[model samples]
Target: MLLPQALKKGDTIGIITPSSPAPVLFKARYERGLSQLERMGFKIKEGKCSKQTQSYRSASIQERSEEINDFIHDQEVRGIISTIGGMNSNSLLPYLDYAHLKKHPKVIMGYSDVTALLLGIYAKTGLTTFYGPAVVPSFGEYPEMLPKGKEYFEDVIQLRKKAPYVLDVPQEWTEEMLDWNTQDRQKQMVKNTGWKSLREGSATGKLIGGNLNTMSGFMSSAFFPDLEGVILFLEDSFKDIATQERSLSMLKISGVFDKIAGLIIGKHEHFNHLNAPFSIEDLLFEIMGETNIPILTNVDIGHTFPSHVFPIGIKVKLDANQGTIEFLENSVSE
Candidate 1:
């Protein structure tokens, strides 16, 4: 696997709007995210799609791909991050300069709908991509980026913390929804209940996965990574039990459950049980049947506050019984 170079203090981080027109729609919060990066001692270069908008997305499909390709061709840009995630990132896959990215590997990070790109890039070029925070939703939190979230980002991207270490379960977290435009206070955080071990076992394998709903968009395409011995991690936001069943069933029918060595489920933000008699866990087990594997859930990842940065293609050990994840290799080269 190819590991991008660790970011340095003065590195230039290019920002792209792969899907959402977040920079245009949420100008103040967008600027705040950029400011956070600048304050962290990095230079920010806004991509072409940064200011463009086409109602739901930042730009047309071709324009969005062009924005990413431009960044890929720029030697000055050490990393690329999305302003936010939306619905059509998959449209840019066929047009991306994956070969160029393979040769000039750099850190590409984002979560939610950006999962399409993260998994696609990794699958096509064998270069690690991050399933982590995005600009408007994460780094641009009111007042400032959540301290723990910032720490986790730095730990992986900047190599401030090395591998062979277990990720910390945050002491507190929040899925509180506030009006991003009119919000004037920090989110209300609750005490973390910590990760839950659904199945007892341990497995070490390559790390891979992102937003579950987004995976369905391109799962049948060649861009999707092979799950053969991966410790897959999945998360979603604002989804109900019914949707969760369908998403899980997609994996089951595809033989995904049989291929993975372990599973790490991120905390689902605003999950609606819909008055169901059974929880998602019960549904998962029902679909899984006798296919036993190590399973851990409710860990800090995805849309939740203070989420951990997961590097796709890195080797990781998941101890489900203990509810711990330990990275076996550095996510980036020094």
Candidate 2:
């Protein structure tokens, strides 16, 4: 797998609005996010779509794709991060300058709807992409980015720490929501109950996956990465039991369960059980139909605060019996 150069203190990070017009909709929070990045000692270059808005999305598909392509050709930009995630990032896939990105690789990171881009880029170029925090919901949080989330980002992208290490579960986490425009303080956090080992086993394979619902947009396309022997991680937010069934069934029907080595499920933000008598775990087992792969759930990753930064295509060891996840190698090069 291709690794991007490790980001340094003074490197420029290009910010693009591939889908949502968040910078315009939440101007105050958006500026705060940029301020936080500046405080981290990184230069910020706002792409054309950063300030543009056409109702739901920042711009048209052509404009959105061009914004990313512009950053791909920019020599000074060492990384690109989404301002926020929305529904149509999949629309930008076909128009991206994948060949240019493959030749001049850089760190590309975001979560939620941006999963389409992360997995798509990794599939197209074999360059590792990040499934982590985005500007608005994460970095733009009232006072600043959550400390653990910041550390994970720096550790992976900025190379503050090396890999071949186990990931730490934050002692506390939050899924509380506050209106961004009128928020005054931090969201209320609760003690982490810890990861659950749904199955007792272990496996090591390449790590690949992101927001479970977002995968539906491109799962059938060439953009989706191969699942063969991969330790797949999936997470979603505000989804009901029915939605969960459909999404899980998509993978089941696609032969994903047969191909993957292990599964890591991140903490679902504001999940709606739909008053089902069965839990999501029970539903998952029903859909999986007796696959014996190791499965770990309630791990901290995705929409929740202080989430871990997962580098797509990196080698990882998943020990479901012990509820541990370890990165087997560094995700970025010096």
Candidate 3:
């Protein structure tokens, strides 16, 4: 995977609404995010379609695709960030000029629906992208950026270091809102409980995988990555245990589990098994039994607050037994 240059303090960060129009529904928070970037010594560039809203998409597919292409082609923009995630980002894939993106790669970060873009971009150009918080979720809310979000964001873009990094749980986690209009809200702190190991073992490979639903959607697509030698990280929100099992079963059928070197299960929020009468643990163990690769569950990296930001297309060594991940190489350009 190509490591884009690490962002400097004064570098320009382009903000685009590739899926949903965040500025339309969260105008105040969007502005707050922009202000936060400025305060952090980074220049912010808004995409032309950032505020445009359509029936189910943030903007017309053409417009959103163009905005992303333009940002990637802009020499002054050191990195790119999506405002938020939404359904239908896949529609913009055909319009994306992968050849152009390959010529001028940069840091592209977002999560949830943005998973499509992250994996698509990686498959097309071999560029490392981040699956983490967005502007609204990370920067624009009542309180300032979530501490873990901010720390991981800085670690990936500014620290320019490799991982094998130990995951720390936050002392506190919050789903409540602070007063966004109040200046002091930015200083309010949230705590976390740190990362916990579900299965104990050590394994390493290229880190791949994202929202299970999103990855499932791309199963037959040309953009799906070569799963061999990959440590698959999977997570989702609002999905029942049955659905989760179905998705994992699909992966198993497609030889995804068989191809990967390891598996990392991130936090699955709001997941409940239906009347199917089976526990999530039972489903996971059943599906994972197909592969002998080291499997780690609940690594604290998805659909939850205070998640870690790691390169999706880079090599990673996961020691579930030790509760740690080590990177064999740096994730950014020097």
Candidate 4:
């Protein structure tokens, strides 16, 4: 995988609204995130799509693609992050300047709907993008960004910590929902049970996957990375077991489960089971149908508070029995 340089003080992060016009939707929080980024010793370059909005998305596909390509072409921008993720990021794929991005090779990070871009870029350029935080929902949290989230972000992008390191499971976490514009108090914190080994075993491979639901839009495209041997991690927000069944089946039909070296299931943020007769795990096992590979569930990674940043396409060891994942190398170069 192509590694981008580590983020440093004074590094300029280009902010683009690839999907949702979060900057306009939540102006105060958007500015708060920018202020926080500046406080962290980085300069912010707000993109053309940042302040623009058109209901569900920031702009048309051409405009969004232009906004991102502009940043990719900018020599001053050290990194690129989405202001937030939404439904239409998949629409910008064909128009992306992958050849330019491959030559430029800068850090690109975001989650949820931005999965399309993260994995697409990685597949196109072999650049390691991040399944991490975004502006409005992460750094823009009321009062302040969650310390653990900030630490993980810096630890991965800024090299605040070294590798061969085991990710520390947070003592507590929350999926409590609050209106972004009206949030006042911090989210309700609940004790984290940590990772669970649904099946006992271990395997090491390049880490791959993001929001499972988002993957549906682009998984069949050439932009999607080959999951021939991956520690496949997946997560979602507000999805019910039925939707999960469909998505998991999508993976199954694609032969992902059969080819993957291991599996890591992230904690679902506000999962609605719809009072199903089966658990998510049960459904997963049913869909998987007698796979012998190592499997870990409820690993704290995506769409959840204090989530660890997983560098897409980086080497990782998945120890299902120990319920741990250890990074084998630093994701960013010096």
Candidate 5:
């Protein structure tokens, strides 16, 4: 994976809406997020489609694609961040110019629906992208980002050589209502449960995986990377365990599990079960039983609040025994 240069204090981070438009009703929160970035010592450049809206889409596919393409090729922009993830990022895929993106690889960060773009870029151009917080959701929230989220972003942007082996989740996890217009509530802290191991062992491989549903769309596409010797990290939200099992079955049938070195299951907060009696764990163990690789679940880097920023397409070592994931290469250029 090609690591882009680390963003500096005054680096210009471009914000684009490659998916849904910046929520029209949440303009204040969007501004608050930009302010947070400024406070963190970064400059901001708004994309042409940042505020554009068209029938539930951010902008026309051509417009969104051009905005992203322009940002990546612009030498002045140090890094690129999505305002937020939404449906239909795949619509921009056909319009992306892979050759141009390959020539000017930069830090592209976001998760959820943006998984399509991130994974597509990685598979096509070998450019490492981040499955991290978005400007609106993480930086623009009423209470600001959780400490772990902030730490993870700093580590990724600074390209830290040796990040501490900590997977601390915030304790005071809240979905309560608060004023989004005020900075006074931006300092509240939350509690988190640390990491957990599902299978007892150790393994090393490149990190790969993203939003399960988003990934499902890429199942047979050229964008799905070769899963050989990879630690498959997956997570999802709003799906039942049965659907999750079906997706897992798809991966299994696609031979994804056969070539992987290990598995890292991210958070699946709202995964429900229908008539199926088996739990997610039971399903996972049943499907992955033949692989015998290290399996760790609930690592807190997925469709969840206060998540970590993970670099896709980077070589990482997953030590299940120690319950940690260590980067095998520099994630950002010095």
Candidate 6:
């Protein structure tokens, strides 16, 4: 895998709205996110799409692709982070300049609907992309970004922390939502239950996966990578059990379960069971059938506060029996 150079103090981090026009939609929060990055000692460059909103998305596919490619070609931009995730990032895939990105390797990171971009870039270029915070919902968090969220970002991108480390179970987390435009307080966090082991055992493999719903957009395309021996981690927000069953069944039919070395199910944010007779885990087991890959669920990642960043192509050791994940190697180069 092509590891991007680690972000350093004063390095410019370019921000783009490949999906949502969060800057226009939530001006105050968006600017706060930029200010937070500035306070962290990095320069910021706003992509053209940041200011352009078309109802649900930032701009046309052509425009969004151009915005991201602009950062890719800019020699001074050390990293690229999404403003927010929306529903249409996959539309920009064919238009993305993968060759240019390959030649100019750098950090490209985000989650939610932007999973299309993160995993797409990794699949095309063998460049490790981050599945972590987007500016508005994460860094722009009111009062200040959550310390744990900021620390996780610093751990991976800035090397503020290092690898050969086991991820800490955050003592608290939140999925509480407020109107982004009128919000003024930090999210209310509750005691975290931490990770749970669904099946007991251990396995190690390159880490891959993001929002399960987002994968449907680009799955099996040239943008989706081979999942053989992958430690697949996925999560979602507001999805009901029926939808989850269909998605999981999609993966099952595609033989993803047979290929993966293990599975990590992240804590679902505001999940609805829809009055189903079975729990989400029961649904998962129904779809998984008899596959015996070590299964770990309720991990503190994706759509939840105090989330951890996962690099797309990094070797990871997942001991599901112990409910732990350890990065075996640093995901970025200096």
Query: In lDDT terms, how accurate is model 2?
Result: 0.94
By summed lDDT, the worst window of 10 consecutive residues in model 6 runs over 158-167
How do these models rank on lDDT, best leading?
1, 2, 6, 4, 5, 3
Q: Which stretches of candidate 5 lie over 4 Å from their true place?
A: 161-191, 274-276
Q: Put down candidate 3 lDDT per residue, 1-334, tens digits, no spaces.
A: 6888888899999998988777877788888888887877899999998778886678888889989989988999988988888887787777788887788878898888889999998998999988877887677755466756778778777764454465555666644445544435544344554445666677878988888888766666888888888888888888887778788889888878778887887767666667777777678778867466666776667667677786888888887777667766667886
Residue 87 Cα positional deviation in candidate 4, in Å, after optimal superposition: 0.5
- Across residues 1-334, which tens digit of lDDT does each residue of candidate 4 receive? 7889999999999999999888998999999999989999999999998878899999888999999999999999999988888898999888888988888789999999999999999998899999998988899987889999999999999998889899999999888889988888888889998889999999999999999999999988998999988899898988888889999999999899889999998999888889988888888889999889999888888788989999999999999888889999899999
List TM-scores for all candidates, in order. 0.99, 0.99, 0.91, 0.98, 0.91, 0.99
Query: Global lDDT of each model?
Result: 0.95, 0.94, 0.78, 0.91, 0.80, 0.92
lDDT of 1 by residue, 1-334 (tens): 9999999899999999999899998899999999999999999999999988888988899989999999999999999999899898999999999999999999999999999999999999999999888889988999999999999999999999998999999999999999889999999999999999999999999999999999999997999999999999999999999999999999999999999999999999999999999989999999998988999999999999999999999999999988899999999999
lDDT score, candidate 6 = 0.92
RMSD of each: 0.6, 0.7, 2.7, 0.8, 2.7, 0.8
For model 1, what is the error of residue 312's alpha carbon versus the real structure, in angstroms, after optimal superposition?
0.2
Candidate 5, 112-204: lDDT as tens digits: 889999888888889888999898878887756566677778877776544434444455453334455554565433455666788878887
Best by lDDT: 1
Better of 2 and 4 by lDDT: 2
On the 0 to 100 scale, the lDDT of residue 233 in model 6 is 94
TM-score of 4: 0.98
Cα error of candidate 3 at position 188, Å: 11
Q: What is the TM-score of candidate 1?
A: 0.99
